[model samples]
Target: MKHFPIFLAMEGQKLVLSGGGDAALAKLRLLMKTEARIEVFTADPAPVIVTWAGEDRLNLTARALQPGDVAGAVLFYAADEDAREDARTSAIARAEGALVNIVDNLADSQFITPAIVDRDPVTVAIGTEGAAPVLARAIKRDLEERLPVTLGALTRIGKRFRRAAEALPFGRKRRDFWADYYFTTGPRALAEDGPQGAEEALNTLLDTHLNAAPRAGHVALVGAGPGDPELLTLKARRALDEADVIIHDRLIAPEILELARREATLIDVGKEGFGPSTDQTRIAALMTRHARTGAQIVRLKSGDPAIYGRLDEELTALDAAGVGWSIIPGLTAASAAAASIGQSLTQRGRNSSLRILTGHDTKGFAEQDWAALARPGTAAAIYMAKRGARFLQGRLLMHGASPQTPVTIVENASRADQTVLQSCLATLAADLDRAEMSGPAILLYGLAPRAALAEIPQVPEAAHGP
Candidate 1:
């Protein structure tokens, strides 16, 4: 790491800053939140700074930073636009034993200011180690959306109750108390009656939880949308954040998995198409086992769990074991694939209905109504189709599917590394092999990727001979 992250004790400390431009104002905006007494030195101070000083917001002086100006300062910012001035001011601050930051100068800065999401007492600071400020700001924005504005208020209330909660046993018991308060009781009370009601709710929660048995765990079957973490539904993300245990598929993206709670137990129950696989029974057993132990379990799947995800089998097992569970739908590969190609699954004057088919199943090479699927204007998205590409090609061709029918193979849909190969039904197998595509791909029949940046090779006009 280029720099270490530390939260300084700013109470009764001094913060020195220089400059009168936008940079100074930007730093001042965030620095105003700190408990430190702020001092600004500038030859020509901005009017806003003078007004702030008049209002007792900060101490402003109209002069260049002199020696001893940074005495006893915990932090200093040289926001001068001129490099020479910044260098000079930073030197004076450093001589006084204060950590100095030169605005926009990473190499010369002793510390970098992170993009911060402030909720008063609840603050989230994201740093890219002075590498990518834009990326850091994007992350901060995402967190701003995920976190509620009232979180700080709830945290403040929780802080007041910490003494009372200490009556409970430390470690797991205390953690459970906080968890229940934050996830359920606290939010519910705040919504129903506002912050004042939350206090009563917290007290009731403490009393009930302190006297009651430990919480019983439940299961959440969450669909981690096709590759891209941004495509994940709000509910799915919540399930991951609250999960005590995450049982994920092999195809689930690492970025998506990173969203899970840091302390959560992550189990890779990945099953391969024709390779090593986890037994279905074993997966269900794991779910029930974790739930029975009072752990909040999340069964994380790659795409929508309803389609070709063997969802019924797991649901049956959970039901038989008397386990409580809920499902969070995700954007299936089909929808993502369709989006990648800039086309809808069903279009006007084209296909009126859509079908989702699996390339293979427990019996191997899933059997479907090829005659119905081969009809003109029929649209279908075939999953697990990589290995069974040839089987699908032969069946569709034999069932009167036009050899010139448009086919688009979307690999790693909605991901940074996504690839789209456009071809005809006749050359689907050959095109897939030539592409050397390896990611989880979906095959689209009667659909072709629209004009985009991708260099899609044109399908031959003449159909290949059988």
Candidate 2:
């Protein structure tokens, strides 16, 4: 970023501006709002500048800017309406150890001002690093219209009662109390009885929150939805927001993890297929352990947790520990993979049913009913099949599966790095080996890319001829 936005404490600080025309007047109006000692140096003084000086809003020097004129100033502005003069004034202020701003000259300025939406203590600054001032101003206008004028008063009252509200407890409880006050109680009280009523309402709200019974612990099995933050369900996002501890899988996206509360503790319980991994029993134990301590825990899984995610084992542990749990279903990777290739899991006249299979199980190279799977019009989404491709190929081929049965491998489904490799049962293992794909993938049997359908007739010798 050319300019990093930050709130400078302007109260009782020194600020200098070397301009007297429209530029000077514009800056002075904003400077007057602050408690800073503003000194404007300009030979041709504008009428408003002189008037503001008379009102003791700022100090005016009716002369050209000289060396050391902006000494010790926190911020100095050179808006002289002339490029040559602004450059000269900026050089002087910068050498004097003050941050200089050449108005309308972003390339030379040390800082650029942002358009602000002011609600007193609640100020929102919109900046584009001097790239698009119009867009910034538009956003500011929208925010100003949406924000209620009484919001400042509500915040001020809430600020005064913050310490008293602390008796309600920290984390979600405190957040909930504030949310209630701002959205419901505080506004209603202020409308009915003004500031005094709001203060009284805060006290009543705090008392109710303080006397409320502490909430029980829970474990939510949340699916992160194919590595896309936008694909995450609202319920899953809420679970992350309220969770005191997050236990996520290896495939869970960092973008999804970023949704969790900053104070929430993160525990990685990722397991790899045919590689080093966290023990499943230990993962369950961690969940029950945290939940038993009255902490809200989220077992964040990539894709749908129920789909080959060993969810049953975790639930059994939770039940044995007598900990409450709920499931927030997510978009499974198979669905995303199908969408990427423009195909469906079950197609009329093509497949009557769908199967979700794991290529590897506890016993390794998980076995499926080879006879049933070899039949035509059978569709399956095979997970963890990269290493077991040859096993699956040999089994299906031996069981009379057609060599030309279309199969597609989708790697990193629904993610930015997603790739699709189209092949048939005969070449499934060889094609996958040639691809050398490292990311998690899903293999779709009895499906071909919809785009490739048009070329099917022309490529029959390669894709479909048996």
Candidate 3:
């Protein structure tokens, strides 16, 4: 970020501006909203600038800025309407140790201003680091409409009542009380009986919550999608936001994990193919233990949890623990891989059915119906197939599969580092070896990247079968 967004206490700070035209007027209007003492310096003053000076809204100097003019100013603005003059005044302000902002000249500014949505104590700042002012303004407009004008009043009243509300236990209980007041009880009471009634409502609401039973723990088995944050379902996002304990798989993207609350406890129980991994029993135990503490737990898995994600085993464990749970499905890697290659898992004449397979199981390399899989027009998305390429190749070829049958390997599917390798059954193992793929990948049998079709060499008909 070119400028880190923060709210500064401007109650008694000095803010200097060097301009007399629209640019200066625009900045002054926003500055006046703050409690800062605004000072303007320009040789040729506009009518409104003079009016503001007369009203004592700001102290106006009828002359161009000189060296040390902004010596004690905390913030300086060079909105002089001319590039050369702005640069000169900006240099002066910088020399005087003031953070300078050159209007329309982002490269020369020390800090860039963000578009703001004002709801007093509940203000929202939207910035694009000087990349897209229009987009920032658009977001500001949207937020302004959504936030009620009464929000400021509610927040101010709630601020004074914070100490009184501390009588309830901290953490969830306290949070629940505030949530009810801000979202429900408080708003209803204020609309009917003004600010005084809102205070009465707060006291009444607190008493009810103080005597209520403690909240029960629950679990949400959420799917994070194929390494893409945007592909994650809204329900899954909400689970992350509210989750107190997040036990996620290693395959889940760092970006996806970033969506969770900063205070949330993140535990990585990653299980790599043919590598050291957290035992399934231990993962279940962690969920049950956290849930027993009345904590909201989220079992964040990559892709659709119901598909080959060992959903049944985890659900069985949760059932035994007597903890309630819900599932939020997401886009599987197979679907994302197909989309990346511009192919469908099922086609009208090529394949009528789609199958999802794993490269290995508890014992070793997983077994499949090789005879059927070797047939022409059959399609499958083989997950974790990178490490078992040779086993897959030998099995399919032994079942009379053509050496020329197209195969594609999609690595890091739906992610920024995604790569696609096009090969055939004869060279599937060899090509995968040469690629040196390190990320999670899916192997597509009887399919090739649509765009790379003409580029792939075809095998002779005589070599169709083993």
Candidate 4:
């Protein structure tokens, strides 16, 4: 926050440097990659700089720092041991509206040179903001370890394909083709074969049809889990990887989507509260039509497809249409929520039965068998009860459930900001209001476990230190 980080584009600009020793030579070498017009001034230039100058590779002046030399320069560097000369050069350079760097004297310099990792066109600059140069170098080294040496070659491939990509008929088609090519073919060639591999991949992609019509396919109703990507079941991951087209809901996180094949078509069918929704019937029809064409379609839903999820309607549509499909179970939000709060839905003695219920019924809960939900020794897990907690609690109480039953409401379960509020069924509404919480909450009500009910300090009293 102290310093604003920005990447400045200085492809073709004038740069001035004073001194010709090792430090100055190093700076000049770094500048060689830039399309900058560099002017070097030194009473005694290093052999490397002298060699470059003799070979007409660099412009050099065998003279001391002068005020006129800073004019029209976008950047200036003073790498001399003379402190007074460095300060004078820095002042002149700044007055001339140029960024100045003084070697070994950061306090007097306007800018400090950063450790750089350059993959030619892709350069990463690591700056410590004048804190620790060694730290910057260490970070650069770490990045160098992860970044492959073939990245530059990959960039060159991209440059070679830029025109062909732009000339492609449709934007979406071009993007799809490139995305597929990058993952399926680009990585292998770049990793093992070098530039020849890249060239072959590009040639193969360019020669193929970029706008081929999608084939007919079957739709798999797959659950993507609550929020955590790691919670994705193996079947779910496999379904995603095999999907030719994926119609995913809002609750599915980006990480889960990333597992899908890069060529797969993705459509967002997010259902937000009080927001525009993709009609479930329409979604089913789309999936069915695509599946009939032999396209491997995936209807990506949040959590388990069978748990309060609209799998009944989708299945009905699929069955009526005679479209063959399968279901991939995912970790339900209720299960994830329970695990996050360190509680089990069905604990021996605490509750003998467990029931899951939906809070909002399109048809009012008047017809719902509330008595079954309120059965003694049964634990109820209510989904989508953010706005109807009081009404739900009242309905349960009126149907033979005890008002004193313990309840736990979990919000954003299994996520970084997950919160759990424990209270009695009678006080559930009040607690929810006090917490000022909203967004996809699940209610757990049953005979409270003695272990869960035990009071404990908010923070551990003792700090475990070495």
Q: What TM-score would each prediction reach against the true structure? A: 0.79, 0.88, 0.92, 0.65
Best by TM-score: 3
Expressed as tens digits, the lDDT of each residue in 249-293 for candidate 4 is 887777788998898889898885555888888888788777776
Residues 324-369 of candidate 2 have per-residue lDDT tens digits of 9999999999999999999989988878889999999889899899
Instruction: Assess candidate 2 and give its TM-score to the true structure.
Output: 0.88
Query: Could you give the candidate ranking by TM-score, starting with the highest?
Result: 3, 2, 1, 4
Candidate 3 per-residue lDDT, tens place, 1-466, comes to 5578888889989999999999999889888989999999999989999999999999999999999799889999999999999989999999999999988888989887788888888989898988989999999999999999888888988998999999999887788899899989989999999999988888899899999998888889998999999999888898898898999999999999999989899999999887889999999999999999889999999999998799999999999999999999999999999999999999998799998999998899999999889877789999989989999999999998988889999999999999999989899999999999999999999889999778766655466554
Off by over 4 Å in 2: 1-4, 20-33, 44-56, 132-147, 457-466
- Candidate 1 lDDT by residue in tens digits, 1-466: 7777777788878999999889999999999998889999998988899999999989998999999999999899999899999999999999999998999999988888899999878888889988889999899999999999989889999999999999897755688889899878898899899999998898889888789887787999999989899999999988898888999999999999999888889999999999999999999999999999888899999999988788999999999999999999999999999999998999988788999998998889998998888777789999999999999999989987778788999999999999999988889999999999988999998888777414544444243222
| Best-to-worst ranking by lDDT | 3, 1, 2, 4
Please list the residue runs of candidate 4 whose C-alpha ends up more than 4 Å from where it truly belongs after superposition.
1-12, 17-32, 39-65, 76-91, 99-117, 122-143, 164-167, 176-181, 186-201, 210-332, 346-354, 366-378, 398-404, 414-417, 447-452, 456-466
Local distance difference test values of all predictions, in order: 0.90, 0.89, 0.91, 0.78
Superposed on all Cα atoms, model 3 deviates from the true structure by an RMSD in Å of 2.6
Give the distance in Å from residue 347's predicted Cα in candidate 1 to where it truly belongs: 4.4
Q: Which candidate, 2 or 3, would have the higher lDDT against the true structure?
A: 3
When summed lDDT is taken over every stretch of 10 residues in candidate 1, the lowest stretch is: 457-466
